[model samples]
Target: MRVFISGYYGFGNLGDEMLLDALRALLIEYGFRRDELVVLSASPKETEREHALSSFKRGNLLRLFAEIKRGDLLISGPGGLFQDSTGPWSPAFYASHAFLALLKGAKVLIYGQSLGPIKRRVNLLLVRFLLSKASLVVLRDESMSDMVPRNKLLFTPDPAFILSVGEVSGLRDGIGIVFRRWKWDLESLLRVLVKMGFPLTLISFQAEREREDGIRLSKMYGLPFLTPSNWAEALRVLSTFKLVIGMRLHSLIMSAMTFTPFIGISYDPKVRSLCELLKMPFLESPRETFAFSGYIRDIMIKWDRKSEGLKCEVEILREKVRSVFTRSLNLLLGREA
Candidate 1:
């Protein structure tokens, strides 16, 4: 089967990239050959080079339609692709793509997606319509299940949760921070880690302002810094730490994948939800910034001893998440022949 994928891919966001990687891995695991897949990416060259998959630049309607016409299935999402809070156009863009695929007679699988805080009436209607047309809808959490037809929705953990990194036998004794420019006192948090005598490393998952913040923090604190060139590099950096303090959802997800102990600083509900799902401590940004430093200090003291327990918890979820692809494919493709 020819599969065309659509999402927030190829822009150097580690979380989305990892999701795409997981989706490709799922396709391969289910016996799809390399040439049978096509991706709609913002950076086609990077997607092609890094993923070894055929990619067409996003927003080219002609290309999108042509791909839809040629493909047997069009899979969109595994991200917050249906939300309007980001912008009015964000929901419209993703929903329209799924709509187009349906119009072209391609089976649509909305995979590993987090849908809505969609308060806007028009966007909700659009999402409802688009999802109604989908052959399968796999959600990352249970909250969105009511929004879709009961038969169409399946609740699964984030696809990235299925991503695996083996345990590091001698994990370095230090704290790793995934930094982003959020409305929180990051410097104070860094100072607290330093005062606690944990050597610091700042990791950036995006090429945007977050990378700039990571570099700035590294320089100011005289510590190591990394803006991972790819997901493998990101996973490698994450595996080295005894504890990971992360603001990005995927950073925390990677922590879980590597079985690294973590504390999430939630700037978004997605982070908070994942933290809650993993039973990890998280502080809301700005609201909890003042107490975050002390919280980190306390967690860091016992983090090493606590990691195995955390790993066990995450592994349980990992198995369930890995099953999403198989279940989805069996449902979506099994009906074909």
Candidate 2:
């Protein structure tokens, strides 16, 4: 069957790419052809690099409509798709885009996704309308479920659970710290980690970087700052890093999938969910506690203890993928429930 995916993909952000990665693999395993999978990405480069199937710019409405019309199934695969983390109308990006496919008469399935505590009335109504059109929907958290309609599509872990294949390594002496907005403190983190002899590779995922936010932090702790053009390269770079400290969900998710001893820096409820899945502990960014080096030292010790567990987690993840592919495929093909 021809399938199309729409979400915050195409950005070199690891979390977003992992979802796309996981969803595509599941469909293909269930017998979809590589040529049959399509994605709406922010840019074409991502489609070429990380995405194996056809890809397009998410902003191109006419193209999006055309792809959906051609697809047998349209999936808003995983991540916090329905939330407004970026803006008041952000839910529309996922909902409306997925809705376009539904309007085209595609079987719309929203799997491993999230609903939100809508900050606005319009967002809530928009969510209701968009979700009402879905053939299947699974909100990742219970609190989010109440805000969304009861389609019996209540919950699943983020698609990262299904996407993480494994960690590859070629670390080149420098570690990277990738973050989204409102997640890190630049100066204090630099001083503490660098003094402890940590090498540097600073990264950010905000579409626009605000130098002002990290003024004191960057100047005192001079580090190489960069951003990946999209996730395909990010994964390549991740393969080169010794470790990662990340605030965005995808960055951290990618690091874990690679088995890097990552320090997840967000306490957002969604973030907490991903961490729990891995049985990993995370810090609340720069403010969560003091004696930063000591905290990290302790976590490092625990990571060594739990490293074997990560291998086991990978096996469990693979099993879960087999089940989801079996179930979703059977339903899509009108087999027994």
- Could you give candidate 1's per-residue lDDT for residues 1-337 as a string of tens digits? 6898899998888889888888898889889998999889999999999889999887876777876773488899878888876678888888777878888988999988888868789988888888887998888876556879988888888887766675554646688888876677888777777777878888888867576676677789999988888777888888888889998888998887777888998777778888888878897755565576666766677776667776787788778876767878888867433
For model 1, the superposed segments whose C-alpha errors exceed 4 Å read 166-169, 289-291, 335-337
Global local distance difference test of model 1: 0.81
How much does candidate 2 score in TM-score?
0.80
lDDT of 2: 0.67
Backbone clashes in each candidate structure, one number apiece? 0, 6
Q: What is the lDDT of residue 232 in candidate 1?
A: 73
Encode model 2's per-residue lDDT on 1-337: one tens digit a residue.
6787777776555566667777887777777889988787887775756666788787888887866664378878677767665588788877777778777878888787756646778887888877776777765556466645564454555556565443465444556777556735545666667767867777765545544444434565776666666555566666566667777777766666566656677547766666677777677667654655675676555755554566577567657656765676577668845
User: What lDDT would each prediction earn against the true structure?
Assistant: 0.81, 0.67
Residue 164, candidate 2: how far off, in angstroms?
Answer: 7.1
Q: What TM-score does model 1 achieve against the real structure? A: 0.91
